[model samples]
Target: MRQVLFLTKIFLKNLFRQPSIVFSSIILPLVVLWSTWWVTADLPMTFELANAEQDVSSSMIDVHVVTGSLTAMAITAGLFGFIITNEYRKISDRLELVGYSPTTTGFAIFLSLFVTLSFSIVITVFLANFLAAPKDPLGLTLAIVLVSLIYVSLGNLVAIIIPKATEGTLILLIVAFIDLMVLTNPMGGGVYLESWTYYLPGFWPIQVALEASFLGNASVSTMVYPLIYFVLTVILILFVRNARARSTMSFLSGGN
Candidate 1:
């Protein structure tokens, strides 16, 4: 336990040391979205989602815009998860050399992600609430944080499978673009409400956020689905990453 804690502390320090990541992942993305949201206050969009239809008002627009911003943040967090884990491959090997088991190191990596997501959800929700507080603050924030897990796990999966940074990021970008369309549907196509859309990880949180911020009448399914998806996704990614780590450790031991 102490070993895991020590490694997690070091991992966090390295993760936050990147100024560009801080700006790109957290600061710059939110700022641009908020600015656009401010400019479009008068031009509010009335979206007829799967469950609720938003009315045209500054508050309604704020909720819609902030929800979209949260989507962008989730995507960013996931990509950073990819970059951070990929960057640490060498250090992970060194830790193994020093007798830190794969399980210990793996927990540390996930602990860092948990910390990142917690801070991210808090700050972004605080900012969104400043524009207009959701009727159910607790539920909205929890849903946002929970949904981010999907992207984070996706990133970890990508890092394990794809060795090239360029390829991994491009893949995440394309996948996130599709998910964003499902969540926002700025085209007014209403295609997102189709049966196929509910299968998406983005759908659950987006639906829950819509209900919490606008109608305040989310179904039980909305609250439950994201939890199931997030847990399953995280569990699957951990097993895959750990298995890969063990394979790599074995190879390293053989070489020594």
Candidate 2:
């Protein structure tokens, strides 16, 4: 436990040392959220999703703004997860060489990200309430957090597999823009999303956020689906990381 704590402290210290990262993790979300809110403030529109199940749709346009902002926030969370894992890969190897367990190091790195994400969540929800308050703030917050967790796990897995920062970032940005900004964005053509979009990572979270914003509640299935997806993603990440490590070790030993 102490070893994990010590590593967590170091990770956080190093994380805050980078001004660009700090800006992205904190200021960037605010900028995106505010910009979204500004553009839609005058629209005063409502949307009923195709094949709708609920009457309380995104009516105020504020709900749309909130959902968009939350998407941006989730994207940033994922980016942070990718960066921390990528930047600290060398240090993680060194720690393992010094007798630190991989599990402990991994947990510490996640802990640092969780701390930063928690702060981002609070800031996002607080600002959204002032600009576009949800009908059920608590539920919206949960929905947002779930989305962020899913993306962060994804980001971590991508970093492990790709190992190239620029390429990984490009992939993340492409997915985020397509899934959240285009497909799930009620203000745009999201109402006509194809059935296949249901499988996208951003789908359920936006549904839940819309429910919370306009209806004051979300369905059991809506909430549970994201959790299930998160668990599956995490399992895949662990499996991939372990397989990669084993492959590296085998190659180092010349396939002996």
Error of 2 at 153 (Å): 1.1
Candidate 2 has a TM-score of 0.90
Q: Report the number of the highest-TM-score candidate.
A: 2
Show where candidate 1 strays beyond 4 Å.
39-60, 183-190, 249-256
Model 2 bad stretches (over 4 Å): 49-52, 57-60, 99-101, 190-193
Instruction: State the C-alpha lDDT per candidate.
Output: 0.70, 0.77
Writing each residue's lDDT as its tens digit, candidate 2 over 99-118 gives 67666777787778888778
TM-scores for every candidate against the unseen true structure: 0.83, 0.90
Q: Cα deviation of 232 in candidate 2 (Å)?
A: 1.2
Clashing pairs in 1: none
Give the alpha carbon lDDT tens digit for every residue of 132-242 in model 1.
Answer: 567766667766776677787778778777868999999887777677644344332467577887887777777777677666556676788888987887777768767
lDDT of 2: 0.77
